[model samples]
Target: MHQPTKPTNPIEKYFSVINLYHYYFFFILFLSKVPVFWHFLSLIFLSPPMDFYCNNTLLIAANESHKNFCPCEDPWWDKSLFTETVQTKFDLYCDKKWIVSFTQSVLYTGTLIGSIFFGILSDKYGRRFACTAAVALLAISGCSLSLMPNITSFIIMRCIEGISAGGYIVAGFVFVVEHCGPNNREIVSALYHVPFNLGHISLAGVSYLLRNCDHFQIAISIPVAVFVTIRCLTMESPKWLMDQGQTEKAAVVMEKISKFNRKPHGSFKEEIEEYTAKRSVRSGHMHFIEIFKHRRLLLNLCCMSAIYFVCGIGFYGVSQYIGQMSRDIHKNIAISGILLVPASISAIFLLKILCRRTLLMITTFLSGVFMITVVFIPAHLTLLRVIFACICDCFFFMAFITAFLFGVELFPTSVRSSALGFLSLMSRFGQIVAPPLNSLPEFVTGLTFGILAICGAALCYPLPETKNIDLPSSLEDTKTLNKKNTLGDLEKPMDGQSTDIDKPDTSKKT
Candidate 1:
């Protein structure tokens, strides 16, 4: 609410100030996630064997001394290409292939542990500390994958990467949103996906050119390693600093940001003044336990957990099976990642028009429809499946982005990052289950899709809509939330008429 400080120097009056801190903000924020991006890449670049046939040429050339007949039982994969995938390194093909799924589960188990661990760390030590540790850990374990001696080692390394990923990703998302004014909040929240989509697209192109998982691992790992010093460069969130009652430190952090962004030093003064002035109501400290105090918040947590889990499954499930959709694995993966750019941008506008609850429900349901349909398209129809699968990913991405921002809006900032960490823990739990569920489609065609669809419908209606009001800062700030239906809030905002920062909160009205 406060404007940046005006320049006292006479020469400064003639030149215009351009806010440049946003670029650096995104740079470090996004770069910190390089290793986490590998979560998707490993699956694609290290694709498991879905098809197998004897090397027909070997069979054709066999002399009379050997049985020349083609053997389907232990068929070698036809026309496979890739220097290394975790799957290939350990001979995890045919019958022993469940090992691939188990490795994925192991990675998520680390993520699960990391979510809880780093969450408490971020809350206790600060976002900067938690984020830096997560990134550094990610770089170390991720690059180590290239040197794995056996499947056991690979599994251990993957789990470590998962743990670190949980912290960095959660810390980064919360940090960016916490930096913004109300006008910038929604867009910044949605745009958080840009970095990941950029990573996803780059992953496709780089993997295409690199042609080996070992190189790919090292390629993505080194940047985070290189940028490890960013922790020193960045400051703790001023909002968090304020909540902790360190007003002077929070003000200093805000001033540094204002100088970089070229905003008047007064730019952050209003928020700081308001927080200090209204300390009792706005700066109430929240721990993980407070997250479950209200019935509405608790239900939201549960529904959102299920919804996020389904999206996680859809995300990894569709990605792993993209090869099944088309002959060109590279082409499909490229398209899938590329689609995220427009999908993310589109969500920004849709959130304004549709409200958060409807949009998530509709998009998720549509994604489910696409997934179920993908299964029935007859495996041989490659082009059609490709078309349908890409469409599913688009909707899934839309829902995923919405649900992410939705979770942020539903909680007070006191516990926002920790709340997200808890959600991350649940989502990773879903990811843990995802690898095994990947095998489910093989046994029961279209089954996974149906389950996701049911989850979308059941989970979408119970969560409160946040589009019409200011973000909550305390549990007291969210007391009215439990009284409103998740869907009813769309018609009548829980915060009294879906007001903006400029409007007064009318929750006490009637």
Candidate 2:
């Protein structure tokens, strides 16, 4: 007599279906990334550091000695291009120049808090709830920026927006990737950033047309408002639903997807039940601390944190200062944004040829080299400086895409959002400190990002490659990551093929 074979992951089986919901949801999620870029990169245009001269008669003696008269309470701003900005409105020049940096730093600080808060929220609740809540807050806070009467109120609104942006970033990413199968995961994840880059490109045009920071704020917030209204059309991650033991709900979602794909709805209850029975017994839900319980998981987190710190500082620091690189700030911003499109699009193809680790290492190291090259260029050649800076930023952007994709695959489903949130927090910390670097000498800022990028590239060596491997389901699975034989075996499976380790062999001799 022959033994019966058990069902494999029923949810994963649906992952390969190119369905209507998949296209619709992917578009919605990709669109979500646009607001994030708009919010984060808005500071460059909103608080643009314009040339200013102190008009205070009391500072006549001080002004005579200083070539660049600034740091005064009241200054006459050069508003030929921009009529009003945070720098001009708040008198964030001369003595108050540090406050200019504070605007960017404070926004990142909000993102820092959001990372931890929403990370936990996603894990405890669901990705859908966390995403919707975060975007709603983003919409409200962003629109409120135009109404802020004082700098304090403006800072508060920016912080709130940052928190929401951070949450949307991690949650939205997890939501999209979880819906994809290994076959399309890398490509889908990489293409997600295309809209984000488009946001970057469009911001320059928007900022050029709307010079007032208030109008720019209102304009950018409108899309997020539209997103909040349509968020209901999207569904929660079935992988997350299954992980939480809500197999019935997961099966329902899978059936909906099947129907949208124009395929006959098949029952998934038996497969889901079989897969759930094989999982380790659980008491309550998994917490963020669960990653610390395992050595490999902890190491992976630490390594990613260190690299994320560099990426955060390197990318944001450069972006914050890129406007100052040339006389035509608008042109520089637009060009930098344009370069990211190709860099982001290239990653989709690169992932097919190279493993995750190799691609990251190459991009990060080159980012450092290009940044350092910018420092050596003569100031007379502003065009060269802008070109080099844009190229360097492009490489840094690729590093960011690789990091997000790599980190998602590094941890288990139970704590994936939590781990990513922590990494994002570290990155935000890097962003917080980045603005201050602008006050330093040009070489110092360049050298800081350059050294950090090189160090980050080195850190990538110890981490295991996740290309074509199944996402870990539990803490125990992460422990085997460091073992040579385990990774060696997992890498053998062809792209899109199921790893035997994840699926139990139910067929045996009777």
Candidate 3:
């Protein structure tokens, strides 16, 4: 058999060169998430309390007459090892306990709104535009947090911080996933979580570095806050450009992709033109409504929504246990946070061996088992309980990563951000449910994990699989999934066209 002759264009020749620049922006955006969860974690390590014994004499005199819980003359919780917190600044303890929960609730409320707002922005305005704007929002809100004067101001800032984080996360995730080739999608998608774990670790480290709560907030906020401007330097996804009928910009981005990767120039222009010409006008203008018009799309979205809901609350529920446990909260969080390194590595290796369907089932099933087992351990066996609980959380974390990658692989470029945003919104709601569920154990010891276990087991089964397969590039492609079929077209590039990039590349990197 005769092989087709190679194209003579130097650009085409360059196509055979090794590709490299695909992930630069991915890493940049990944680093931006460094501060997203720190404030929440700070609550665990930094909350302050006044020195007051709840004696009847003190209580009656304080309430009936003219004294505060702690005498203004007596100040406490200012030890060398630990710093003051908003809880202490406002004296939000005992009867004021609801305030802490209320603060977090407002944050989630911001996230809910951000997810919807930014998801639409990603689908409509463009990834680069939306992500850049969100970066600004998140950074500004985070920086302003340490400056807030009253609890009302603090809670209001937290809500702003949540909204900003909401936009950053969804747009950043969508941007990175869109910019990469198929070979690295799982690693890149799962890579988002690594920074989250890092954020927790760094929050722990910085909490130690800056002893004062206000300074600690500045320390954590400043690191990521500085990088917000970097988003302005990043490029939009070529695939997103193409989906929106901006073929000219898409061509420019593809050229940049080739340059960054140091691949020899190839015929990216002709290939994009051919693909775009064949695409229908309706494909250019995608609506969120369009995502569910097809049966397969509807079924897949519904199942994915359910899984996000369960996994969202479930992951938080497990983590909160370790937080609430009688042992060292910092050590337990550090150790648990470190577990993500292994969980991420396990995901990277296992993704290559097991089909996505098999892996999703196995991880969720095991996570469920571990979650359930946490309930049966004798309370006297505290060490054993902690270990079991940590393992349960590790697996849930793994499952959560798996779901992130799977969701990216499931949707097409035009609507991928919207789909993921919808999932994130549901996840937030589940997270909203988690704190309340954690409270439920006060009434019933096993309530939270028991519910999560059932959810972990039941919710992961409905979605179609995409293990080691090509992703769909359009609604038409996604709509074609048969309930019984795996996503077999995983090798297809985002635009659904064969390009010189697919040809053999014996050339070494320049």
Better of 1 and 2 by TM-score: 2
* Candidate 1, 1-510: lDDT as tens digits: 422221121111111222477667766787656556766456657653444444445663344333322333443443346656665566566567778767767777887888778877776677788888888898899889889998888888988988888777787787776665443555777778877877777777777877566887888788768657767888887666766666677778867876776665664555565546743465446777866776867887888888888877776666666646457777766766787787889888887677678888889888888878877788788789877877787788788888888887788767777788888887776666665577764525356755675677568776766664445666655654532434334344222123222223333432
Mind giving the per-residue lDDT tens digits that candidate 2 earns over 105-211?
A: 78888998898889889888889999989989999999998898888898898899999998889988888889887667788889988988788888899998999
Better candidate by lDDT, 2 or 3: 2
Alpha-carbon runs more than 4 Å astray in model 1? 1-19, 47-80, 84-88, 91-96, 266-274, 282-284, 372-382, 441-448, 482-510
Give the clash total for candidate 2. 3
**Candidate No. with top TM-score:** 2
TM-score of each: 0.81, 0.88, 0.85
Best by lDDT: 2
Question: lDDT tens digits, residues 26-112, model 3?
Answer: 567777777766755665554633334334354444453333344333323334455577767776765676797788788888888
